[model samples]
Target: MERKLVLQRVVIVISIISLLFGSSPVFAELNTDQLRATFEDNSILFSNNSEDTNCSPNAAQRAGDAAGELVGEDNLKKAFNYFISKGAPKFVAAAIVGNLYQESKGNPILRQNKGSEPNPLKAGGKYHPWNPSKPAGMGDAWGIAQWDPGVAVLYWQQQAGVQGDVTSLEVQLAIVWWQLQNLAPTSRKNVLAEMTASGNVNEATSIMVKKFFGAGIPRTDIRAAYANKAMSWEPDPSIAAAAASGAATNCSDDSGGGGGTISEGGLNEEQAKKFMMNYGENKNNESQKAMGGYLWNNCNGGGSNCVSFSVFFLNKFTSTKGVYTPGNGEAVVSYLRSNRRVPTGKTPKVGAIFSWNGGRYGHTGVVLGIHGDTVIVGQASCSGPGKGRGDGTQSGGGSGFIRVGKINETKAWLGRLPDEFAYPEVDMSAVANYVGASTGGGGGNVAL
Candidate 1:
């Protein structure tokens, strides 16, 4: 009886150990044969485009001509071959080609309109001739993939070493690959692995559309059809075989720890709201000495006072002590990046530090809230209406009053605070006294 009891006790301990350290379940690789069969079954659901209509007699030549009109047949083939050479599956390359076709019909130099310049990176204003001397950011998208010429031009120049004209097919393709490899390496790896495993043009196209294109257009059916068309365009057999054999080589590793995960532990929503409300009330107090200058110091200019404001917020709310405060807005971005605090995407959340490149000093703000496409921010700057909380677009001018602004008109990067930081309980009577002492005249009265 004693031996049986001991045996039962040992079995329970072993079961508990297994539960604690068992391996996670692994998903099976998709079967290529099944994917092909499914695609064949769904062929009738695909759109009947020009490629489908002219599939006879000189089918190969006609298909080549169609691709040529967009980016030239040779360039299209080159992009496919390049992807395969880099160990990406042929299906993955085909998926990208499908998206490119939809974006510009394969034309590398295509602009939003017929006569506009290929480079859209110009100063924010009316579209005009390419000055080459002034800053870019004028019009809509341009290039083979219809990229925002303003932003795309900078990346192409700096990353790819492409100079002079920014409309070259080769340069655009390079930028595309660069973005996939760098911007979201984990997503890229997953897409590549899935495409290689399945060898399904349609599924690969869908993944690229969602992950790479940011869902710019809602034409998944059309994109799937295009991917099928691209797959029919044959590539060199040797390149395809090499790509298949080297499937283990990912274009890039997730060394930066997948860009999507925000650092854990910070102010929760309720705590953030409480802090902002207090901060806003303090901001409206004209008698407060900090209102006249940046963070209680009299430093007025066209430059932004965001760094000072951000530092004050961090010092007051979190347990962080003696935080380095840079006056320049761009410098603040550098500081956050150095600390590994930059968030992954442009989407704004409450408590995010928003940064943008605006002239010499740039601009920075703390996100108050995000509603649909607009982000509400608290900031100090020369461009918006002077001082006091507004939406994201308000200007701070020379006086260093806290202001709120609306930020859907421009692009901004975000930096998140370390997760371990949280709001601490502090006395609020000082803030109430500051507001009560205000003469009701000095604070900037910028309205939304």
Candidate 2:
């Protein structure tokens, strides 16, 4: 009993510490049980929502829940807003609430290792910080959704799969969203349809148990109660759309990964910085998908090359859109010059839309930072990581599937670089915000 109490205190302390760390993993603070649950790589992106938007935490605290007192306001709000942002209806979000509460009591970092139920968490000692650096043995379930069969780690942690704590509330929820939308086998995907079919919270709860969990239904009543409580926070329509369309970027602070917006037409330094910082932070698969939807709907950017990518950024972060002509990437530069939307420059500046006319199709990338000789640029192609290829192509140069590549970033310098860069009057950053050490798959410290 004393040990349980001690762990509970530890849980509270960790929660406060996590808040202080802001989107960074506090895995080193974990006891074995906690550490066992973590495995991460930034293959997909989901912004943090440590603070619930549109609604405040319900004051009716459920103190004895998972992770002890830390479960109530923080985790619940984070989980609900996260699912909702991914276009889940309230009940769909609520259903996830029902299932997760039953699975791990809303704890994003909960771990239960290879053991039959009744006495889960047998792998309590299996979490040696070094273990996650390798493949997890079969049967361990980790994180909020309880991703099972330790092998799931292979999928969860892509490039960094060998190691890391990708278990921020957003990352865990992104895992759930990724599973439901793309990764889950057919049966699990059906739950997304079924849950969205009706607002019947109880029915949705049952559906999650049978369809998503693939287990005998248990604790439907308690799970339903949690689901009901989750629905308490009314969501905002615009924010939901933005969350569904684009990955979160707090253009204002970049304090930690969470939902921050550019407020549409308020484009300038914030717009360029948001683009640069977010790409630096992640620029992963789902980041492409979520942001791809925005790129498509707004700028007609569903193509397979540089033109589509640059146009998407322009139509999105800039005030208005014009000249979304279809063709090789260089044509975009000509159109911009003809329209006089941006001034041409030889030296690359942070937030400049660079145009390379050397290649047949030409190429384009957005400048994020300047490290003296090298300009850190975010680019996309049906061929690179800044997000040009895969299924994320739909129309002229605007929207679709979502793929990112380029094994390593392509580097360029001032004198010869792209020859031309286009940016409104926005000076994203005169100096490097990515100086010393950094975190995130995209690198350095920036907002969520």
Candidate 3:
């Protein structure tokens, strides 16, 4: 009788759980206002009323021509004309706008959903946040030019001096225009220089044009456009004047730690010892401060701070003090290349160091879990997650898997975790903090 009673209770509990978790959700989808706001974050504008064929097919070429009407043309032209007043060439300005349009779909105000599908790293499965129904991806890559989150934020801060909720598409759009006006360069010589440096000027220019439109426009046509506007178009002498003249500024939370923040949950024995040692000697006994300093000075910047967070973590985990010998970043990269083992796609267990962009440090993230080609990872602030790059948002942080183990030259290395690390024992706080914290919270916690 007791067994039957227990069984009945179990059934009731199961039924309740099903009812609570199974269907008929109560949360509502975003309304139009929210949708508009989201789109507003990732969009841009440009035009081509110029005689130069290069400037002809600006944002208006594809966006306006397709819609059979002008889209952000007046605003774009005004901004272009303003650049001209500032000595920017009209042709050069059009070319700049063309680049933006190709990159950003010419919306000038759209949101990039960081949680959106086809995760760039190609992580399998969609991101399942606590609120499953919440929107995925962060926001669209806004403007006529599609700048990533980091670049976008840099442009915004440099130009508009605006910072706020990164998720707000409206703010992102404003930043987009501000970036075009103030942060973007307008030197025809510089443009030509960049084209020439790419090995094939025609090919490079063609790529730019293709990026703007769906193709069919030839390089010759694009060059003609450029030529028409080249001389007639004035140069914007102060294209980047805003950034140069602005106060000391920082964009994209720049904490060397990934995402916008750092979490110091995982520490091997040696790492813990080093943390204690650093704190034991520092004037400020705060572990957080020490960790933050370490990230900024040693591990976060381009060259000096280029050591992989995990490499530093391992050195500290092993109680190795000051593994960060002063030298070019190449030495550290070489060390990782030599010491780290590779993970075959078929069997990528946890604790693997993954390199991207052909070992160029184009981007790096730690593999938290692996299943087939899909990999779950924790990425740092390699780029911005929303429209306005530096706007503090957790979208830039936290744990998400990507499918990168499948690619070649993309190698993974296995590291020794402390004996204390059991399944579910790995300290993912850094990973979590990276994927969850905003730019303001960029504290390097692994070393701590």
Model 3 lDDT per residue over 1-448, tens place: 0112321221000110101111221112333344223223222111112222211122211111111112223434434433233222234335444443334433443434332221111211111122234223343343333343322332233224333433233334344333332233221111221221122323434534443222343344544354344334333444344322211111111111121111111222222223223322322423223234555333223111223333443343222234443223223323443443211122222443433333334444344433223333333333322211111112422111122233222332211211111011133344324333211112222211
Model 1: CA > 4 A from native: 1-74, 122-138, 160-165, 184-199, 237-448
Top lDDT hit: 2
Candidate 1 per-residue lDDT, tens place, 6-38, comes to: 312210001101011113311112133332232
TM-score: the better of candidates 2 and 3: 2
List candidate 3 stretches off by more than 4 Å. 1-94, 97-204, 216-224, 231-235, 243-448
TM-score of model 2 vs. true structure: 0.34
RMSD of each candidate relative to the true structure: 25.2, 17.2, 21.6
**156 in model 2: Cα distance from truth in Å?**
3.5
lDDT of 2 at 294: 43
Model 1 lDDT-worst window of ten: 10-19
Error of 3 at 322 (Å): 9.2
Query: Distance from true position, residue 387, model 2, in Å?
Result: 47
Name the regions of candidate 2 deviating beyond 4 angstroms: 1-72, 113-138, 157-164, 185-187, 236-448
Which of the predicted structures, 2 or 3, would earn the higher lDDT when compared with the native? 2
**Model 3 whole-model lDDT (C-alpha atoms):** 0.29
TM-score of 1: 0.34
